[model samples]
Target: MRYLVAALLLASLPVFAQTVAKPMNDPKTDTFLRQFAETRRFMSGRPTKPRITPDEKTVLFLRAQPTSATQTLFAFDVATGETKELLTPEILLRGAEETLTVEEQARRERMRVSAKGFTGYDLSDDGQRILVSLSGKLYVFERATGKVLELKTGPGVIDPHFSPDGKQVAYVRGHDVYRLELATNTEKRVTQGGTEAKTHGLAEFVAQEEMRRYSGFWWSPEAKHLAYTESDTTGVEKLTIVDVMRPERGGNTFPYPRPGKANAVVRLGIIPIAGGKTVWVDWDAKKYPYVATVTWKKGGPLTVLVQNRTQTEQQLLSVDAATGKTRLLLTEKDDAWLNLDQDFPRWLEDGSGFLWYTERNGGPEVELRKPDGSLAQSWVKPAAGFFGLARYVDADRTLYFYGDPNPTQSYLWRVRDGGAPEKLSTGTQGPAHEQFAHVAKSGGLSVATTQTATTMPRFVVLRSDGTRVGELPSVAVEPPFAPNAQFFQVGKEGFHASVLRPRNAKPGVKLPVVIKVYAGPTTTVVRHSMAENLLNQWMADKGFLVVKFDGRGTPLRTAAWERTVKYDFATATLDDQIAALKALAEKVPEVDLARVGIEGWSFGGYMAALAVLKRPDFFKAAVSGAPVVDWLDYDTHYTERYLGLPQEHPEAYEKSSLLTYAKDESKPMRPLLLIHGTADDNVYFFHTLKLSDALFRAGKPHDLLPLSGLTHMVPDPLVTQRQYEWVLGYFQKHL
Candidate 1:
């Protein structure tokens, strides 16, 4: 398989046009663009939402269709080694267009899901019934009879989940949470007093965008209770996102928490499954306002993790399910700020203790705490970097997790309750470069996706004992292009970077450079995964040397390394990019730094614009997409967490904002292209427009391309393809 992958990579290289200069829209480039946009994505066959049954006999996953951006349900029988399609969008949609409600569309945007037809689904505890929401409607699929039933649950339903016992389906409609009985066909509202400004059982913008918390409610193991969040956004400022393209349709006005602004008032409560008095959890809402996480076990008390506004201190509280009384179990603190860890504060099977993760040992470590909040045992393996815990298979008395000692490689490992951790993934297959696994809780089964530096994603099903069973089929067609990146570390910081020269460039020829970057907090562009650098390869194919790196402030590093930007957001990220470029330029003499260009989206977009505006000597051109020009305009939770309140640190605000440099005469003029979606609610079209206004006032020459009706995500394939062409043409003109 490794040799086959290498053969495919060599075959995909662009055929050089030796005789004449080919048009930019040549067949090769078109094919690359198509693969980059449509061919390799939705319907091209990638498995999502993998579910392993309790019995471990079946593995269910959603597979995309080849003809459309719709997903179909597939089931893999482990015993028989057979993969079969269970349901497709054609049968579920019945040829009807998937019409998403406004609320549902926003939710999908938050979750970054652009595909249609059953984007998400929930499986019952018994794995007998599946609850699916399609086009704002609810449907249930039964495994025993292979039947589908649509429940008339009204309009605007979102975030549906089945009860632990599979007796009822609970979902959020309008602004409140509702429960529907399966047998009686009866519906009941669990909590009341939900309005446009106050919502129940739905994640707020900060929780979804910053904290990575998607759902606002969790069902108890007994199916008799539910713990839901009630968020009141009356304090946060409201912003209207207008659609200038469609004058007939008005805009959507919702709470937008800007820097130094008020955040939503959130409260947690427990209610009976059949509708009863709501028991609100009591905690110091003033001090610890942010509910970072919530977890409920079958026999344990409800657990909540809350943090203060500064995020320096976080407390784990256990709430009484009946009385709503809360007891502070433990408090974790850091001098800078506490980072949210995934799958932390997990409950043990016996319910006598729980598992928690910490970095107090100068590295990542796992701690077992008794029910009384006293620490029982703590374990930290050498070089076990801080990836999240995957699962704790009680049957095997082992816990599985993901971690990487090397920055570019990751793997799966299992450790006994009080024993040394052992690597579970195989290294012989492909070096185990980048791996992810989902270990089933009940059954001794696990599904994993393992990819190497040169290999495409390979999905395999394995037993808890590391026995390989079968592989999930990928319908995706290999792209007619391949990446050839040289990975290395540079500078005293040992910054990770990948340098890709133009594939078609002549030997010893000088090439213009393009630094593709997403040098943002908690993100790294340089990695060993094949999917991580495809776009970088395409840019290199277009005749520019492409560079990518993870500088200061990116995660997967030490807490000190990531906290470099806690008080200063712009310096480390930008300085490191420049340093990496200079270091690589010294090593690779073919790099023509005189004609360098930079491009990025969101935070990277901010970096791109910042590079040309603040350091025009290094970057000659920039393409900024939906850039957050001003830190003050960003959300309170994210911006404040890094730069503090704008009101308190006015100097830092002025220095970090790009608007401050818009008219600086000290910096020389550079060609820049500003692209933004007018319907972008996260960064807001106002950001780009305001920056453009500043540039116009300063008489700075620049180009602006505004996309209408597109949100933060550019879901249209045509637009995505055209975007690459535009950027390429702009670079050609400037460089």
Candidate 2:
């Protein structure tokens, strides 16, 4: 009788111990656990903007530098590793007063002056004068005297360049090319008859954004002539985006062409500096698409790269500058569209031939071709890596380039101009990032390095043989967070998973999970770099597991992975995400799948809404802000890329729409909260209005928060705080 009673007491004691396990927010075991509101308030500090100096050695970035409401730029020296004040508050105020008129001055006093520094500046070949643009006006400053000279005052002055002799400066003004002679103080119009409707010597919207060619003019080596492109937008389609600033007043429209649409026509022309007629380069515009990049050969014919609208076929053509007779120097084609290398092909000093990059055999390979049309014996074959262009081919026939032979990391590579390539810098083992700087006359390379998962970019100078000459000063990041937070990867079935355990996480404690997603076609949410991303860190600090992964349609990857959702964008990508979630649930036992929630912005918001509507079994709640519920609601350029034409593919568009899938409201789906800005031009406020109406008609429960007077990219502090509050509150309630 005594043994039986002891055995029963021991069994009952084990059961009682399981029931008394500490709660997630216990005072003893979970002393660091802060309330969601408190955590959010702690994280909602002032915003920080990054600034890089012209020299690339010092990073004059802002972190809480509050001399004023807007950011203030500081100066840092890499050599001494010291920082000093460069742009004083008095200087900024004076500059503001000089630029603004009397009526504008009163209004500007009330408005915060944001820091708008130099985008790109040029030092004169003699290094005596510096040319910089401040708010579209070109200002020349003497290096030693610090005196400012207004060279050419205009609204659209861009891409200003100085002649080799530093006697003349050329810049783009009002869609036309202009040359300023410093000696005579006279400005001459090189190209004429530019209008708002038609451009004469400047690139159009598509050429600038897609091809990455900002300047349309280039000066010859002798400085005696200028080569430029004139883009004609007479036949291109125009897109009008409504301005939500003033609801009573309608918006303005601009010309924008999408894929397979009629793009602006481009023509190359050369003008002599001595004042002559603009001679059009002879090329069959109908048969061969216009040139994207134009370069003059040293004492030889001019070279131009031409590609079709589809971008599958490419040709490097050499044209006679005197007569405009063109002959194809090299031709390459691919099954998919080829990326046009617009980095101004460098001409060897000898003028025998030039080097070109081709991905014809899968990856970028170097090809040395002669002046006529034959390939030189010296050529770099394709390797199992990516190759990028670096400036200057030295006298020893050594070509410099940079790449990551391994997809996981990047490094610089130097190839003997005629032979095989050799790795110059061995990057950090995991997720290394590198960027090459502007080549110096001394024949050395300036390189920037950042370890894996670091946001702060550091610079270093290296000799031609890959030896480090000097190290630049490091940029500062706030709060001193851990170097390694978390990284995610999609499984074999394409599901999302990330490891976000705290630095001192307990051995066996289940954590709530939050999925931060931006499942869009144009941009990917996941990348191996140091970024102070708001959502990822906010939830991670609140003891929630975070996960982010690319669906099928994100850009900057292989075409096969990107084009998988040709006509079916949402469905295919969503399946991969759902698969990822299921795999993560099986692997991570500490993940509380029952408390899973999803949140996103813009296109990501659309995915969050679909996750609850389509796969309610996986997520408990979702928060979507500025989502595009329907394809037809967006602009023509972005939507037409994946779905072809709306008239032809109405069914595909309908299937992809979230409104069509909102029929089954009786299921045990997660709660949804939709947020939008009334004045969003990119996604438009109508998206939420239409979506809300559909949800109401289907008898679905949703929360709608409308932000007034906010644009597509919301920068308002109050609006951002409210947005974060609404999202965090929704997840806490449901999850």
Top lDDT: which candidate number? 1
For candidate 1, give the lDDT of residue 577: 91
Task: Give me the displacement of residue 480 in model 1, in angstroms.
Answer: 1.3
lDDT of 1 at 402: 78
In model 1, how many backbone clashes occur? 1
Give the per-residue lDDT of model 1 (tens digit) for 459-498: 7888867788988777876655557778888888888888
lDDT of 2 by residue, 154-247 (tens): 5656568987677888877777888889877788888888776676666665555445566678787778888888888787776544433354
Candidate lDDT scores, in order, read: 0.80, 0.60
Instruction: Give TM-scores for every candidate, taking all chains together and pairing residue i with residue i.
Output: 0.94, 0.76
Best by TM-score: 1
